[model samples]
Target: MSTQQTISKHLDKSVIWLFVIVFLISASVFAYRYKNYKTCEDVAFTVKAKEFRVGELIKFTDNTDQAANWEWDFGDSTDVKTNKEVLHIFNKEGEYKVRLLVNNICQDEKTVTIKEKLFIIDSTKLPVFNVKSSIVVGETLNVEDKTNNASTWEWRFGETTRVNSVEKRASYVYKTPGLKTISLVVNGDVKHTTTKQINVLPIEKKEERISEITGTNRRLGDGIKARPLGYEDKDKEKTKDEPSDKPKVVPFIGDSQFISKLELVSNNKLDANAFKEYFCGDINKNIIVNGKNTSFLIFCEKIKNKKLRIKDITIYREKGSNCINTVTISQNKILGIF
Candidate 1:
């Protein structure tokens, strides 16, 4: 009874243990396979950028698993891109909705804006002066000027003087003056003129001027034809043709021009003669006076170190003719008189 019963019990136990081991191995293998297999819902899609300029190109990407296919919508009216990375252009300036679908189940959406950035003109030239305001009975008349970006200048001081200056300064003499008009032209383009009223008083009643007459080392006032007729040291002299240490007399000459002697006294008195000498038929070369040039009348005054006041400027077709027109000037306006 002991041997038979023991063998039968051992066999039964072995069979039950084998069945349990096989069942456990099969269950473990099935669980591992289920964990690795991915569905369309498990994949994720993304866009690399969220902002772009107007008319700029953009790209979309997918980082999803089991995403063998992709579809894109750029919100603009255009065809879609089926690749993982698709190129798109934003043509308009506004916010746009971007959508990407991966494997027909995974999806991502983004919003971006395209924009354009916001652009004034400025032009005006400097002012030129033609004449001064007043002169004393015995005061000297010196004309000068200051300007920029000008290539030429013309100055005219009524019938007493006409000057052409390449420098910024020139001069004229008015021995007697009631009223005169002074004019200036720049770059052969712009023209400016003013009329002044010179009230001549007695020599004793005039006031002395604050400045004195001196030679100029630099070029004379504004753009004109004449080179500087001033002075400088021997070593600091300018070119050979340029006038150095020499003074030119301001002459008034023309068929209708009158030459007058003018002087400024120490007491600020302006002494001027009213249309004294005749400048009729005086043939000359490049005759420049009062900023105007002709063949007979020449301006010879060097106003580097002098100051003169102008009263009125009258233009006539001929000498001793009636005043046809007049120009008025302001008190605050600055002038260069030689």
Candidate 2:
């Protein structure tokens, strides 16, 4: 054979082997991808929930084969999680679309409806008793139970000679006058007990009351008095000698007068000196205005521009001393009147 012909034959053989190898590799890759695609298409999952109420927990389970990873979306604007089995809780009552993704490629979804739970027991409605705290002796006392979810009731009338009853409502009469304790108990899975006191008073008699009144009058006559008996002339002389420190009676001002004063101040008809006299403190350039210590001129300037009226004024006096302590004035448009 010629050298050129031999070299061409070898080159042709190498090209054929390379083509076969390439075909084999392509076929293997195609087969692998086809298997994975079929597995993804056949992916399935199930959602299990014991209850569909708010605050209930739900479980998600992936039931597909050939899955390497899992992801879940609870559809409640929450963060997505990656797990084969996931547990989630809904905070509100609404319909939520739950989804499960297998191998990050195949997915399935289901809608869950969460509703609000009803028939919840309130703590305030627990077993309780209601009865009058004071009753006169010889009068019948009636008591009622305000208990809830109780199957039976027990009541104790707190009398030595009285008998207890299992009825919800009970009545008892006492012949004595004093403090008495009443108790109640409700029978159920959990027993509840409550106790109260009643003050039983004795009926008053007119003859015994008249003697008591005379005795009280005698005790009052024995106490100290402002003036001695038959000393009215001397007491009048002493009163003339000493001047009283009592505050003189001032005529009550109506709401109209207060409104007129406010209007005059706002219209510049009333000066600051006159306005300051209405307050209890010393008139100066600065005073507390609206809880803040500020210049009196600024305070007056603010009110002068606004239409204002005094709503109310309360004057407080020091106890025993009877001297005026402070005056609180409430205005319709302005604050901080001390």
Candidate 3:
């Protein structure tokens, strides 16, 4: 072969090999790019901000696995950050689109809103009111809101979970005896509410309780009020009973109230006397507790030092005078194994 023809032939062979190598390299790169695009379904990240407001610092963190390269566009500014985590502050209050480019391929976007500054109110400067700290049951409890700027009022008398009154000056008569909480929400702002506590005292020993009913009450039946003083006939009790003037007054107590008082007695905060009005003014009224027979006063004393979980409580009342007839309780003593 001629010398020029041999050299040209070698050059042609070298050019063909170069083209084959370039085609193989391009095909491998295209396949790898296609695999990465298919598996990048979950482009996950987290944004942490104590409060999303103007001038607040917001932290953006990329949570994608095997994410080596990061591109964060906070969307508020044209600047982009290349880091796994970045902190940015928005200068204005509005919604902004946030975007992230993971490993220069996986792309995702989210929206963040910056809010205006919230109005702050001093809770100490909230409306104040006045009420008597203690009052007898059946007596009217008067309250007056003294806040000068208060035109609307919401009053809740802790006896029930309800708004009892709306006037600036309110009054309520308690039917049961115990501590009660009174709340006032002025200007319809319940967040800055003012509250007061009042104690409704039971009828004292000296207080006179006239029987409104005409029929005579059951006297010392079924070991109830074990004392021999006949409650029905004053004439029969004039000689047998020790007291001659004052009629024995039993304070009226609701079934729910009785259960609460029992809990207080278990905590040692109260005693059997707390339920005097429930049982013909006799704390020692006979009753059944968890199928065990015992006096009311003795039952209270038994659980006085116990931490108890009340399982069930039942109260029976005389239909005539609404006086407590029988009480059955089922309570579990907690941490009192001995």
Candidate 4:
């Protein structure tokens, strides 16, 4: 071959070698990308929750690549949700297996624990007893439970009989009563325990009933008629000396009181008149916080510059005592209670 023809042949071989190298490099890169795509097709996600309390809303965010659809199984036997960012609520307290299905092809799962929320028992939310703080021994005491979100109840009558009941409404006749500590737990959760004190009077010390009519008098006819029934002679006395029939008013000073009032309102313990006493403005807004549509009462408990500026306040009407369910307040408010 001539020298020019040999050089041409060497150049063609060199070009062919360069093309083969480029093709190999391209194939390697394509393989790597395809492997990554397959790995990504199996959804990658993160489940974030600030709290895991029952009845709390949790948000799950999908961070998967090339994901076209998202499906979530909260493991509560509820409906499955399809969204890039899904919100879920667990009503019961337990460990829930949360599964995420991406594009109906790949799935990932996480276990979340739902714990019982710490609840501050309010007396106004509890059942009202027919008997007063003091009752006679062997007297039947009637109690009606009016608590909110309560599915079950356990009551300890605090007598020597060791009596207990699971009914929402119960009556107990105490055989012996002195200073008794009556306790109740709702929803079978010990976190909802409430206790109160009661006094039982002995039968021997019972007071005699007074006659409706007065004894005979010499000066006046029928002893001046003994005044009219339900008539109070003290009414003619000074107002300060006479007791008022109105309920004692308690001022809302800090966030603790505000939260207490909110609980009372939610549990149907507070009437409309009492509701207006703590809150100043209209509280009928349907606002949502933390993905819940229920009513929430939020406030700043700290007195900044000797004045408190009310923050987010939401209120809505529901059918039962669960109307006002959630409450969020300043940290100072909780500290102030102590």
Candidate 5:
């Protein structure tokens, strides 16, 4: 072969070698990228919570690529959960290492710091309030602010579920004869408020009776006789001396005395049933804390474990009956009492 022909053959061999090298490099790059993309498809999860406090429910959701099975370990010694989306609660507060295992192979973890729940209302922090206890129907009740910095006040007299009066000092009158609940919100802090109950009495009425002597005209019959004047007087004296059989009146517990008992009940359970007769024979009977009407049970719960300052209490009775139908209280109430 000639020198030029040999040189051309060598050039052709070099070009083929370069093309083969380029193909190999491209294939290697593609394979490396595919491997990394597969790795990115591994199992993953997320945790959601309203608050990191004990007794709060926490949510765990799986987000694994092509995941078929899921297992959750809350790390709080709870049951091993098996669900794509699961809820968990931790009884005790502490740092928990939550883990999610998918398909029994891939895993992810999160650390949750749980805290202790707190009493939402601090009654000790509330300001003192005052209102007149003797609230009568058709009479205006004046609610006075005893503390400083109170810019607004909203009062509800339990007649209706609406704010009847709003001012730094408010006045309201209850129309019906029932347990009346008075609510006071200061400075628009609706969450925390002062609640009072007062019994509005009906209009007073007086009852009177007149007695008179009567003369009787009698005719003497064959077998009838008239008693002697002295004998009749003696009979009257004996009848007066004999024991009377009239039923004695039942004792009544006045409203003022019941107010004393409630003032002492701060957080203690008192004998509210002592006045059951006044409340139609059931102390637990719903007497309005009067939530624009709060139940007696909820009112008791709100006063638990707190120092309560009672401003006043009123007892309202029916015009002719000794039974009390309404009672009101004024106090510095905790935030959640109502």
Candidate 6:
């Protein structure tokens, strides 16, 4: 064979191999482009509603894997977050159409119903009474009126029931004499009860013991002389008109010359207005001191200080009322007798 012909054949074979390689490379590039191209249905997605309430937080999870973005329409006339756990509030009560659009490719939706819940208020009550002060024992006192709000009433007299009833005015007679506790329960509520002490004394006990004292007229000017007062009852009287117990002092002082008509109390407390009405002048006053009672009468012309300083001193019996042994004292130094 000729050398030029063989060389020409070899060049043609090389050109054919080069063309085959270029064609194969172009086909691979076209196949790669076609594989990567996406349709509208590729990145599609949808969302399903789980559960929600009027004030509850709901989550909308996008179940699509290829979706790039999510759009949530919470159907409450408001837009909500498009995350996995999206929170939304349903203010009104009704069925809601909750819609979700995924990556502009696909759409998913669900419906949920919300309702209103009822609420109640809490309260506390306290008991009350009408009268609460100064209850005397052994006295059948009427109980205070109970209001209509009190549906129940209970009474406890610190003992078994001698008188038991639901009447508003209840009587409780204290059998024994001492401090007694009384309780009243109203409307199933208990309150701190009050205590009343009864002072019971015998009925036939003697009442008055103080007897009147009189002195001679010539010796009366020696600063008003009088013996130590003694108690006398009806039988053991030193004089015929005296009672015969230990005679208590029946002393009366007034502002006038009339002194015999005033009423004297047993505890040495005297009523001055009665003495003043019996006497003519203004009844200055009288008081008891050191187991002795004395009376005074001072005129307005004899006033020294702005206030009258009436001296009520202790008086010892000056030996058959010859001269009364006494000590001068201020007004505050003696027990007051009005």
Candidate 5, run of 10 with poorest lDDT: 282-291
Candidate 4, residue 164: the lDDT equals 74
Every model's TM-score: 0.25, 0.29, 0.38, 0.33, 0.41, 0.24
Model 6, position 135: C-alpha lDDT score: 45
Higher-ranked by TM-score: 2 or 5: 5
Clashing residue pair totals per candidate (backbone < 3 A)? 72, 0, 1, 0, 5, 16
What C-alpha lDDT values do all the predictions have? 0.49, 0.63, 0.74, 0.59, 0.65, 0.44
- Better model by TM-score, 3 or 4? 3
Per-residue alpha-carbon lDDT of candidate 2 for residues 27-58, written as tens digits (9 for 90 to 100): 99999987766357777777777887778888
**lDDT-best of 3 and 4:** 3
As for model 6, its CA RMSD to the true structure in angstroms is 31.6
Looking at candidate 3, the ten consecutive residues that score lowest on lDDT are 329-338
State, as a TM-score between 0 and 1, how close model 1 is to the true structure: 0.25
Backbone clashes in model 4: 0
Q: Quote model 4's TM-score.
A: 0.33
Alpha carbon lDDT at 136, candidate 6: 41
Stretches off by above 4 angstroms in model 4 are 1-38, 41-43, 117-120, 127-157, 164-338
Pick the lDDT winner: 3
**Candidate 5 residues 117-233, lDDT tens each?**
533665653546765555556887776766457777666665543467776666666665645656666777654656665666776777766688686766667558687666657
Per residue, candidate 3 scores C-alpha lDDT tens digits across 229-257 of 65476677676966556544455676677
